[model samples]
Target chain A: MLTPARLAQYVLPLMVLGSTQLMASTAVDQQIEQLRARVSAHSVEVNRFEQELLHPVDTRVAVFLTLAGRNGLEVDAVELFIDGQPVASHLYSKRERNALERGGVQQLFTGNLSNGGHEIKAVISVRTAKDQFIRRESVHRFTKSTGTHRLQLALDAHAPDYEPDVTITEWK
Target chain B: MTGLFHSWVSAPAIKIFLLIALFCDPAKATSPTVPEELSEGVVRFALATGDITAALPLQDRLKGDSADYLRGRLLLESGNVQQGLDTLVQVAQGRYHRGEAALMVARHYGAEGDADESRNWYQVAAKNGFGETRQKARFALAELQRHAGRLDAAGKTLAGMDEGYWTAVGYLNLATDFARTDLNPSRALVSLRVALAMCETDTNRERSKELKSRLLVRAGQLAYAHEDYDKAIGFLKKVSLDSYRTPQALYLHGLALSEQGNYRAAMQSWHRAKKYPLAYPGVEDAWLGMGRGYDLAGYLGQAGEAFLAASAAYEGERATLRELEKRIREAGAYKSLVDDARNADLEWFLADSRTLTQPRLAYLLGLIENPVTQRAVARVAELEEMIASLEQQERDLTVFMAALGNKPSSDTQGRSKQLSADQDALTNAVAALSGPNISPAQKRHIRELRDALNASGSVLERLSNVGGGNNQRQPRKRQAERLRKQTQSLLVEVRAVRDEAGKALDRLALEFIEQEDQRMAFALDKTEQQIAHLYEYLALKKLDGGKP
Candidate 1:
């Protein structure tokens, strides 16, 4: 067991361990210098990321305007005029009430305005068993010229979520 | 005792000991109330044989009498009530473990609604120092009082707990005592609250916490009934249903939300309360609260849905005479949204259409804020519809423009000049040098007609190129002219089209304004609701236990 080969093996392992320790210490010293240089040259941009063009409230809107009542609500009557001449009204209070009550009320619109100001008026009145309330009145203007006109009509109606998945999928 | 125990299906002490063991080391998950091995075998045997007969023969080999009383209970639970009763009766009359046997027999009789028989055995067990038996005796007596409509007597009997047993259980009983009577709920709450504080261990604390939550909810109900909205809100505040199913508490919370003008929050609370499977009679009202919240908040769509659900749920439910109409009214409120949303949509759409463009954009913008603040469904619909119109108009403009690519601009100046020259010479040419062929007035009119012809020159030039332009300009121009005779009409349509490229500068300006206005409404409404909710919550809390 105490042969020259054994002594040589033990001595070689000791030498290898000593050299590795020496190398590790020098490596640590070199890394410290390199880190200092990196720190001195550091110029980082701290930018805040932003999400653009994603609007949170772009969904179509639908509402059935009515005056509150003790017994039940009443529908709003709509009268439309083009240049002071009575034009066809797409919606009247009674028609609106029946359609909305029945369901799947999607307001569709077409045709276009060739720019410039046009006036629109909306009035809502509630007639009930005991009293009547002129709930809402408004007049506004719309203008379009030269290009294609985009028109959106929304109807407010909420049914139930009890329909089967297949039925709901077919709504569109 | 063996005879009695065998007749009883098992024994009593063994069952409780097993349960205690299971409770002690919960880290070791158990398969069922019975041992896992017993469960598998029993289940298999029961399924295979369609009765307990086969299970009995195979199950007798399993060694353990620890759950003997529980075994009898299992029989009862499995719907063999008569057999279970006989087994427990035999055990009670057995020589060994007389106290446990008597307790089981008492429970069996009590379960069967045989109060007299249960009381007799309970008394015997109580005399024999069975603590649980003594409590049953008290409960039975209280029930008897309850059945007899003697609220005071029931409460007194419950309160007659021995001083040694004056734990949270006693307080809970006291709460129940108050619940069934015309007593002050606050007093009942106070009693329970004290008991909650008196809990000595985790189990007692957990139990007391639940009881306290329930008591507070009841107290809230009483206060709410007395029109003490703030007090009721406080009672339901910060209570979680993790420990106990408490619909009354949630309902009170919703009630407070509605009172505070936080209709959306109130709706949420009521909706949650409606989800509770075991609700009080007021649960129906919780559904009503959801509809009412939406109606008040102006969220017609959600309100209608809530009302309809409430109506459906409460269909054929019994109610007080006054509540009959109230229920119908709630249902009717739901029906109103159809018209409500319509009105809102039309009104909002009209306003939105006018306000979304420049010059009048700011003015129309203000009209929608209040409606949006109310969360009007129709208002939302109109906003969306109008935006869609604007967006479409912009799209069509681009498509038509693309279609008319490479078209030359028209030049109608020559015709205009010729017409103008003729108008100047019309009177000179018409007036006969020798004789007055036309009157002075007629001559002037002829000159004006020539001038009008001169004016038509430019119009003709517009027409000439309209026929030759890209993609037939005549039809489009005519369409535009039909909408309005104003000059400004031409400019808005011109800016609307877009290719695959981004929207034209003008269209962008217009569309951006419209979309931003809509987003502003939703934001404003949401913030207003939130602020109102906070204010109400704080105000109610102040009124409940502090300053208002």
Candidate 2:
């Protein structure tokens, strides 16, 4: 019953079937590997996009304010107002007063403002040589159409009275 | 230096000779290499120094739209506002610096209190300007709307702004305006909350914290005025403990609790509020709240004692009203002095021994207490386990494949070695036959034999090696045949599991998103309900003599 031809018939077909199955399996494995790689790449891209969404580039107006100097007056406090609304008011600490007295510039306020004409009002409270307290106010009008606006406030001393001459100027 | 140069170059004879030389060199005579233009820098320096006169000459020397703009700025700075605006408008008509010029014109109008004109120009600049300029213009337009009392329009304008510190401030300002008008207290509360969330910088932290605490107290007060005791408590409890508003917040919290009939809890809140510095404004309120709590709980004698203490604390002030004094007298009549002293001592002892307890705030607090959002966490854990399992399966598969020992090159290598041995034998035989002493015929025979051996070896090697197709495929076919069934079945199972896990992960991700959406919606709904209850309570409070 187990003749050579009969055996060849059974063995050959089985061998062919086995070879085809092996090739098909190998092809399937390669496909799975390729798909996994694609999924990995896509996941990485999604994570990158999420990160971008979380932290975006900064594109906002920057206003730089500096108190230029206090001339012969012991400035006790400075208050800044924009369009009649107070934006910043600080009572000068002893260290800050000393820094201003030595011609050091103090950054008063940095914030965003709309493009148009804006008025800056500075109120300076100073102690006179006689220990009298006096407040001086100055206003500056400027246009913020483009770029940065740098504002400086300086106190000019009047000779005889030593009155605080407060001036606010916008630097280009 | 100028005088010395003049003396050397302008002597009579030298002048005559120089004139002759200039005439001979016509290019040099006509063109005195035009001095480098320093007008732009000069104009900027003059502007910075507030020197309009100095800028005027430099501006005149400048050409193009920038010159016109600079001249306009100079005129504006010099107090000639109309002239400056006219000049700037001309520059705006040009393409260069159009946004800047338009913005300047807008500012001039704004300064004059012409809001309509200012808004129009701001719109132009917002459309034409780039980066921060555009943002500023938009913000200015919104500010104008707010100033014009168009609250809704101002809110809409602010909504379009990008999330930033200024936008937060804008929201805060709008919230302040809303609260001042007393139109939509809930909107103000929401805006203040958003501002608190957006405050990220150290510089803004203190301000935002203070603002948030103040707003929280204000909102609590508003709720209390409306008689929405629960919402009042909720809002008051959120006020930061470290804030100066804490004393007032705690007093309000106790009042809300007492209104809700949680007299013991109200007493606790009041007791805690009293622990703060006694000089605080809320101290009298705290004592009064404690007395009310005791009175509501039917501890009339202890209530009388608390009221008496409060009266002593606010002797000269109306903090202890006539009605409150009458209530205290009535409570004193209900119990004997010894019993009142014993009850008071017992209350103090109990209050002192009490442990810190969970805040009875709101459903939101309940949600915060257990914030896992369970299903999402479970799904994530499952996905992590599946990934780990798959990794282990992959490692096992690698080990199995390595152990299979499917070295298909071994057969070809053996054949190659056999062919080399035969070729060496043929070479040695030829060497022996090719000696000089051998006959020509013998040499010919040896050559023929050598050629036959070499040809056979070449043919054998060619047949053995051939193209990589059959030789490579035959062994691979054998190896594949040996591995195909087992490896394929395992791979199919692995892939099927992987695909199932992937699908599950996707489902989980979608479910997570939906859950988050639902949670947010629920929170919003709860807030809206609370606000509506407040409105209803306000109506009832108005009917009940409007006592807060």
Candidate 3:
């Protein structure tokens, strides 16, 4: 058992065992590094999803038109123009007139608009008691920075000749 | 010779008499002629009797535009409206009868629903027509304006008219418009009272009475809405018993009486109302009111009977609501099933396609069949079991530590001091062997000695701790504290697993309920549509003379 050949046999196996352990440790370390990287990537995705859920994008301006009141005048048609371009035309039917009488508002235009000033014009055609057809135009200017802009077109009862009044308001 | 002389004398005498008669009454000497007024009266008599054939021959004998106007009227009354309108327009162009003709034309246009044309003709007639025609045309224009919802203009037009039957009709219309369209009950009542006061003509007396009854009912309802029960009852009592609205008025009267706590009077009024041939619109409400009254009066049997009648009347709507409630209950049951099916171990129960027909059940089955869900559930269960085992271990350790006392015995204390001295000696020897100046042979010998000393030190420390009762208590206390900490951590894990299980169950239930809610909504919508269609069919059948 004390011979050099027998001693070589024992020492050689020991050396091989030590080398095998070193290789296994290196592979294990690489695997741990890969796992850490994957965990970091998954954490980033989760944070991004949470950020998106917390805040949503709102980028459009909505414009609404409403008939405030009719002063004993039969309104036949109404046309709306935004920034000198015709956007909507509505011919009031009997049912629509009833709705307007009940204080229902109509959406005139809804689209994306940059932060700036805009002008809205409404042309209304009404029949007077004397059987005379008259066209009354009212214009309002508003600044749309965000949210919605509302315009009310009312038949002015106090006006001498049944003129239309237009007012602009912004949604807070 | 004598006869010839007598004939000559008679001829002279006859000639002298004829000359005197012609000279004395020249006005009556010509053939008798009929007066134009008498001819017009004959044509009017035929028209009034609705004998157009007789009026046709008489109309030809009439002079000037009256004949043409009468022909146009006959044509209109006979339903040749377009032809009559043409004839009236022709007459309207003439100055003699333009007023009447224009009024007729406006009325024709009004009946045809051409308000613009009617208004135009009415304006012409009002400006150029004479007497009653001008007044009637103005009233017609006002009526057209009222129907067109130009209430202010209609009021202005009516304001210019004087008191008469047409004016009364105009006021009645204005009252109805104010009440129904403008929601001005006070103004409507004023107009209606004005119309009632103006009803002096025999022809309009019955109509006015009917309108008065309607007004009384409306006023009573308005007073009821305002909670003026005495005024409501007073107004309702003024409603005529013969009016079609009598039953409804009596029902309202009963309600007003009930509001005043006059239960006997209310019941009497309701009984009277039930005897009416016409059906009351609020009959069911009357029954319900009776039930409430009986309940308040402590008449339990009567109250039950009244309530049963009310329920019968409301059977359709109650059935619909109950059906919807039943659907919700079924959905709850299905949600429970979906919750149970969320467990992967219950997959065998959900294997049938029929069980998966429900969207929520299918979704739960999908999750249960997923390997991730199975693994997650298994991991949670494992953690829970581990926590339970750790808790048991901690409990055992706590008992063991409690059995140990706080202090060590005297014999154990002496052995603990000896082990401490031996440990210090070995630590010094190991430090000396690790010095830089030590030889290899000496280092090898010291290392052997260090190994032997270390082995003995470990055994000595264990033996000393076992024998030293006070030191053994410290280690046991520390072990117990460690087990407690482990048990606490395990409890947190178990709680987390329970929370996860609860959340899973909630999510599955929510999914199942959402699907069931959509199905219920669709079913309810379909039921509502069927109810609406049934009501429409009943209305149509009523129009067709069938029972509603």
Off by over 4 Å in 2: A1-172, B1-113, B121-140, B146-149, B169-203, B218-234, B241-248, B263-287, B298-548
Residue B159, candidate 2: Cα error in Å is 1.8
**Candidate 1 overall Cα lDDT vs. reference?**
0.40
Question: All candidates' TM-scores?
Answer: 0.30, 0.31, 0.36
Tens digit of per-residue lDDT, candidate 3, span A1-172: 0222222222222231121111122232233233323322332332222112111111134444455565655667888777887766766544455455444344444333334568877887877645678887878777653222334444543456654555555553
Measured against the true chain A, the candidates' chain A TM-scores are 0.33, 0.60, 0.56
Q: Which tens-of-lDDT digit does each residue in B449-525 have in candidate 3?
A: 67656655654554454553444345535645665565566456455544555355445444444544454344345
Q: How far off is residue B542 in model 1, in Å?
A: 40
Q: What's the candidate order when arranged by decreasing lDDT? A: 3, 2, 1
Is candidate 1 or 3 superior in lDDT? Answer: 3
**Chain B TM-score of all predictions, in order?**
0.37, 0.35, 0.46
Off by over 4 Å in 1: A1-172, B1-96, B111-113, B129-137, B150-153, B160-180, B183-187, B190-213, B241-248, B257-287, B290-548
**Which candidate ranks first by lDDT, i.e. highest?**
3
Candidate 1 CAPRI assessment class = incorrect
Distance from true location, Cα of B383 in model 1, Å: 60
